[model samples]
Target: MRKLETRTIVVASHNAGKITEIADLIAPFGFAAKSAAELAFDEPDETGTTFEENAAIKALASAKASGLPALSDDSGLMIDALNGAPGVYTANWAERDDGTRDFAMAMEKVQKALQEQGAEKPQERTARFVSVLCLAWPDGHTEFFRGEVEGTIAWPPRGTAGFGYDPIFQPEGHKRTFGEMTAHEKHGWKPGETQALSHRARAFKQFVETCLEG
Candidate 1:
């Protein structure tokens, strides 16, 4: 098989965090990843019902508009205690309130629901972060991959390294929250690079290997 050319691949999102993750993941694969904002592409509505569909929609929109191969991802945190709430709606769930309140709200909702059920919080409040990536070409065809990392939610938040709910999320086998690590520190992958295990990283890694470089 021919190697992927060193062409530009546009990532379909305005979020700096997502763009950074995609750029890092695709950089080693010889693709010069750029964000939609860099290309001046308008944001496409993510009206799809599932993460995969949303990713596809965004990918196609960006690919067609930018006239280049495009990658898009939709990711979220799903707490089993909340019956997988804030799944696809992760961003919007926090839209009406301060970003800092999201985790607290999630925790309160879970606790309240548990109380209503007369069931105590499970010893292990299992939760998982899920990421779905879609790669689209101008021809309208698309490829997809998914990844997940399971963990538990910590109360009152933790360090301030990451954005969003990172302060309250603790991956299994790790004592530090995502918010506690710097961007480089999280991606460093020394003894405690939690970002390497994130859903986005895992999914992008798979996409890079199987779709971009394989």
Candidate 2:
């Protein structure tokens, strides 16, 4: 892996939630993280079909634009019952006609789809959140890390702490949904510590171990 030599990097995303989460994750390593939105960088279209491909696209775009290293993440929810219908299109599923996103609608749609497919039992509602992080340098060199958290879909969408489809996602061994958990609880992974609870946390841990470790 090509180690990230610089301490300052752009987080290639316009989403506020993603920026905050990523910034918090990298802050412990003494990295000066900046979001693409904060830097006035345009969000490149994610034309790739896979998480790795999309992550590379964003990372490379921001790195090239800023002439610095950039980190990008592509994540999604994949349901066993839906046969991963929304894998790469996870965000698209929540996109609104007004150019906004409605995750509550997305959750309801997922629940409805599950019911249509006869996925009633807890076992039948198995799912996972997948994330792939890419680190790219200005010269276009890049590395990728992937993570996933297994879980089951909860009906009636509980909690409101998290954004997106967190209200409907219950990670394995947990009684409460991700939406009910605080940021510290959801992203509780650390280097050489306990296992990660969220997909993004798992992927971020890998990035820290590979690039930020002294």
Candidate 3:
């Protein structure tokens, strides 16, 4: 693993929600982070079929452009009933013709699809959130960490605290959706903890252990 000495790394994403969450994650560790949007980095085409591929595409692009280490996350909600219809295309589902993303519309699409598929029961609505984090350096060195959280799709999406598909995802053992939880509750772990609740957090924990200075 490459030791990341630079603290001010690019987040490699234009998503505001992702940037905020990532910034929060790295804040306690005292590392400075800037998003690709802030740095005016061009968002690259994610032609890869898998999450790792997409994440690496973004991370590497920023690393090369900025000559600094970059971290990128490609995440999505996958419903078993839908055969993971929106896995890598999760964000694509939220894309509007005007180029703005409407996650509310995306959530409705998920619910509609589930209803059409006759996925009424919680078990039938079983799903998982997948997150893949890629850390890339200017020299082309890269590391990948993947994480997942099991959950069921909820109808009439609840809460507004989270972005994307959080309102419709009811994680296992939790009555409320991720949108209902605060950042602390959604992250699911503290600094020294071994486990995390969310897929991004789980993957981030792995990245921190391997790349960041302790």
Better-scoring candidate (lDDT), 2 or 3: 3
Candidate 2 residue-wise lDDT, 42-130, digit = tens: 88899999999999999999999999999999999999999987899999999999989989889889999999999999999999999
Model 1 poorest ten-residue lDDT run = 186-195
Better of 1 and 3 by lDDT: 3
Worst 10 residues of 2 by lDDT: 188-197
Candidate closer to the true structure by lDDT (higher is better), 1 or 2: 2
The candidate maximizing lDDT is 3
- In order, candidate lDDTs are 0.73, 0.91, 0.92
Q: What TM-scores do the predictions have? A: 0.82, 0.97, 0.97
lDDT, candidate 3, residue 94? 96
| Cα lDDT tens digits for candidate 3, 106-171 | 999888998999989999999999999999999999999998999999888899997999999999
Q: What does the lDDT read for residue 29 in candidate 2?
A: 76
What does the lDDT read for residue 38 in candidate 3?
A: 93
lDDT of 2: 0.91
